[model samples]
Target: MKKVLLLGANGQLGSDIKKVFKEDIELICLTRKNFDIAQDEISKLNKYSNIDYIVNTTSYHKTDECEDFPDKSFKVNSSFVYQLAKYSNENDITLFHISTDYVFDGMANEPYKEEDTPNPLNIYGLSKYSGEIAIQNYTKKFFIFRVSSLFGESGASGKGGNFVETMINLAKKDVPLSIISNQYMSPTHTLDIAKAIHYFIKNEIQDFGIFHCCNTGNCSWYEFTAKIFELTEINYPISKTTYEEYKTKALRPKYSVLCNSKINKYYKMPHWEIALKEYTNIKHRKI
Candidate 1:
């Protein structure tokens, strides 16, 4: 079995990648404890010289928090990625990195395609975009996937849990929610992204560049919250608020939905609704 070294192994996306990947592919899972990006992490990977592929799900992805700690954000999101890209290049391993849809300014009415010019609106997006550029420049064999609003069973790494969990908690406690109606995005599941990556590798899809892997359709935060309540059978009061009223430290895109035009023919991406419903169903069953 070919060995794939997975960074951020304990994060929501990383954990699901562990479970969703084919049994035939050997995964060398390494969490923050084992591979801290803040430290000189490239030196740590010298031992895994035989690794065929390196999948990076690591990020300092607290959007608002990133605005406060731009240095930390760039260190983890940009500098460390450059190091990983360099390491991947030296080792001749295919690198797969997770990115954000925040790279866009959210001005487009339709879904952003892979070819869209990235105009990051915040430090987090700028840093992630820097990482994307680094990977493209440093490594010949790499897949940079731009994912948006990701939530999973394992919970997010940087942000507390995820929007779903936060919404669930507030709804259960009878707390009124004020969701943003202007900012739109595709709320994707980590497992779906994992499955797509695994499929591409297993089938040897050499079409490597930046791929936009996200759930189908886009919705404002209010609509997303409504769906969460519907799936979990939670009736809660949620009011729609625009970006102007609901202020955050970081500037978010008004529309940041990613189109899977490239990967759709090879691996079908389920709609956000179906993915969300499936996630809720699985979590409920687990609970």
Candidate 2:
């Protein structure tokens, strides 16, 4: 079995990836507790020899928090990724990195493709895009999966909980939801993402660069919330508001939905509605 070094193993995506790789690959999991990507040196990786691949899900992804701590965001999202890419290049290890669809400025009327030039409006997006470029520069054996709006069984470590869980909790409390209606994105399940990555590893697919790994179709945050409420059988009040009406510290793209162009050639992605329904059924015990 091929050996894989999985970083950010405690994160929602990383956690599921571990589940997917169980008893299949020779895996070495590391969370931020064991190896801090920002502070810990990549030279330490020299201890884990014969690492065929390094799946890095480590990211400082709290968009609002990134605005206040640009240094931390860049260090975790860009600088450390650069170091990892360099290390992977020297060690002949294929690197798999997770990225966000927020790299786009969100002005596009249609879904953004992998080849679409990135024009980041916030520090977090800029840092992630920088990391993408670094990987492209330093490594040939790399897969940069640009995913969006992830929700999973394990709530995001960085954000405490995912939008789906938060919406359900708020609805259960009879709290009125004021969700953004204008910002469109592909709200993907972390399990599907893990499955997609596993497909690549299992098949040994080498067609690498940047691939948009998101659920098919798109919806606004309000629409996403409504679906969650529908699935969870919560008939709560939800008001739609634009991103400007509900102001945020970080600027979000009005349409940051990604088109899975290259990845479609490898694996077919389920629609957002289907993925969400499955997730709710299996995890939340409702659909």
- The C-alpha lDDT values of all candidates are 0.90, 0.91
Residue pairs whose backbone atoms clash in candidate 2 = none
Best candidate (score: TM-score): 2
Compute the lDDT of residue 104 as modeled in candidate 1.
Answer: 97
- The digit string of per-residue lDDT tens for model 1 on 56-131 reads 9999998898999999999999999999999999999999999999999989988899999999999999999999
Candidate 2 local lDDT, 41-130, one digit each (tens): 988788875888889999999999899999999999999999999999998989999999989999999989888999999999999999
Model 2 residue runs over 4 Å out of place are none
CA RMSD per model (angstroms): 1.4, 0.9
Model 2 scores a TM of 0.98
What is the alpha-carbon RMSD of candidate 2 to the true structure?
0.9
- Summed backbone clashes in each candidate are 0, 0
Reference-based lDDT, residue 2, model 2: 84
lDDT of the structure predicted as candidate 1: 0.90
